[model samples]
Target chain A: MNPSMAITEAPGLFTANGLTGLIFLVMMAVTLIGGLIACTAERLVRSVAGLIVCFIGVAALYYFLNSPFVALMQILIYVGAVCITIAFAIMLAAPEENKKNGPAGPLSGPLAFITAGIVTIGLIVMAMRAKFTSLPKVNGGSVKEIGIQFLTSYSMVFELISIVLLIAIIGALVIARAGRSK
Target chain B: MSFLTLYNNLNTFLYLAAILFGMGVYGIVTHRTLIGMLISSELILAAASINFMAFNRFTAPDPTVGQVFTLFIMAIAAAEAAIGLSIIIAVYRNYKSVDTEDLVELNG
Candidate 1:
């Protein structure tokens, strides 16, 4: 008898597998709901809040994918830094109450929906038709391995990204401060 | 391959990423304000990250590569947001409004 056959069957509710699945479903729901609010909310501040919820769900998804370090980083960066930055921008610039943020043209709504629908359906179909053969993992991809790779294999890239971030920060400050009055 | 174990499947993640990407596209097309567009762009970036992490988990031989790539993506996204918001702020200062329709000097 083959040992892997048992995993093919569905686990009952209350079991560990079922509980994990339930949690996964909850995370998915949370992500989708947050995305919906982010896209559809009337107020820009509300959209930022929804984006926070969405990023948290995404971090949880990263956890389920076995990258807890990346998950934590997601929370630390996206929610902590990025969302706060966006919120500040919204406060500084967004005039949500006065101007209506509706679709530009009459056909824009239906056309956008169709375009997005086609894109999503096309990607899903492509993924379904394509056969993916998984290769054996060479390493566990743990935090330590990631650290070593950053130092050894991908050192140039890591250095480049830091430089990129530094330039972005300086550039942003220059651009935003251009029109400011003393 | 039961529904309960969908989390272990690659297609599930693929589908989720696809849907997220579609929503981002829709948001980009529909949202009229610059800040709204920036928010939607974040969704697109998140979708791309999910795709990377999924392939990394289910297919890649060296899983750390995807995580590293995702980290880079995060860095890029942060930089993008910073630059983009500053640009938005500048536009607002010049035009006194963030609405796309208002900034129509180059429209031919």
Candidate 2:
């Protein structure tokens, strides 16, 4: 079912279709490089920056998956909220200056690499080989549909999440405020 | 089968998520600081969401279900980050350090 031209002939460099493909390729590169930087960088600040880049790429991937709502939420939640919160923690906690040189772990260097590689390879192989029965979509997972689902099916979870967020906020303030000198 | 058309394939996103999860595991294992570990844990969560989303896009009977699940994941992750960072702050205030090595009061 694959087109011969799709493989043998490259899509035109100037066309819109080609541009989307190009953008996807770029997003993939950004995600990979950002993840590598996030994992490997010695400094905490740079790692946070890399995390932002990685999240942006993931957002783009969500866009490709056809859920613009989730994609926007990915950017808003991950890049705007989470990354900024982490940056604030880095500033307040000051991981860089306080970073002590020590043995990372007995499994830090190569053993961790091998284990991660194995996990990655196993998952990829499983994903590639598995056959999914494509069930017909009940409703288009649009933003409107999502809103309805929140109000209808997922209302309980929705309320629970709000309570969780409230608790998390109050708990955070209380914990961080404790023992702070006036 | 074209490289440019990877966006159409379910396996592409799956492989991507797997790699991201692997990176997360590696980061958690190797990072010496609590904040760094938290950052890695976020990566793992992101990977899981991507998997849910990919299935939602491709084969799910109720597409809204996966999206809703992913949304819940984001909320949980946010809350987790908040609580975790606060704990790290408390730990830092007490110990004056965030390194796991220095945090070994239980080491026998």
Candidate 3:
């Protein structure tokens, strides 16, 4: 049964749709590899590097999702700002995980893997089974439309997030500054 | 649905998000350090955003809503990262280690 969504017939390898699919597969692979490295890397620095690669792949995925502005912001905020801040924290905290010399806990490695696998399988099954109703597009969801909605419909939420971010910055500075004299 | 056109399907994005979420959960459970947990949390957040965007692209009546929501999530993630990293720094300063096991004491 064909859903309402676009499901093109198989295109030849040199066709535009085929090329786009190929690129998407590459991006998907990049994202998974980076996430694997980030999760399993021995060093924090290498993990951060992997996180960077993962964010870039996610940004590309966002572009494929038809929100180029969101994709660009994803790159700017996540890859550029957030990852850089994380790198700086790594330098400052400098925790090398030297203690215990053994596994993190009795139920950490294998148990964690099993738990994650179960959770993933459950989510995938649920998603596959659920039938989502598609509504006709009201607007193009362009950057302009997003801006208008932000200033109009979502103005309160926007302001609240701004305040929350300000508070977080101040709180972070205060927390980091404490016990510095000791 | 052919593999070549998987990008146009909602299920593909959902599956990708699920896998990423699982990886995040695994990272959080297995990681011993605070920063490492923070990194994994970001992955989880990304997974959530992907779900939002995928739905926005395929099912939403007003598509801008999900995009707007994703933008808010990014802001929140940024703030969380800032606060979390700062707390980690403070914890390190007090205990000389950022490992979860080393942070047993509540005192400064």
Interface RMSD of each: 2.6, 3.0, 1.7
On residues A1-182, what C-alpha lDDT tens digit does candidate 3 reach at each position? Answer: 21346644787768898899889989998999999888877788888999999989999999888999999999999999999999999998874656332238786789989999999999999998999988889999999999999999999999999999999999999999998995
* Candidate 1 displacement at residue B39 in angstroms: 0.6
Cα deviation of B100, candidate 1, in Å: 0.3
Q: Which docking class does model 3 fall in?
A: medium
lDDT of 2 at A28: 90
Which regions of candidate 1 deviate over 4 angstroms?
A1-6
lDDT for each candidate structure: 0.89, 0.87, 0.89
The candidate maximizing DockQ is: 3
| Candidate 3 to native Cα RMSD, angstroms | 2.1
Rank the candidate models, highest TM-score first. Answer: 1, 3, 2
Q: What is the model-wide C-alpha lDDT for candidate 3? A: 0.89
For residues A91-180, write the lDDT of model 2, one tens digit per residue: 998755547322296656788799899999999889877887677678878899999999998899899999999999999999999998
Worst 10 residues of 3 chain A by lDDT: A94-103
lDDT of 1 by residue, B45-91 (tens): 99999999998998899999999999999999999999999999999
Q: Please, what are the lDDT tens digits per residue for candidate 3 over residues B1-108?
A: 567787888888999999999999998888888898899899999999999999999899999999999999999999999999999999988888888877877646
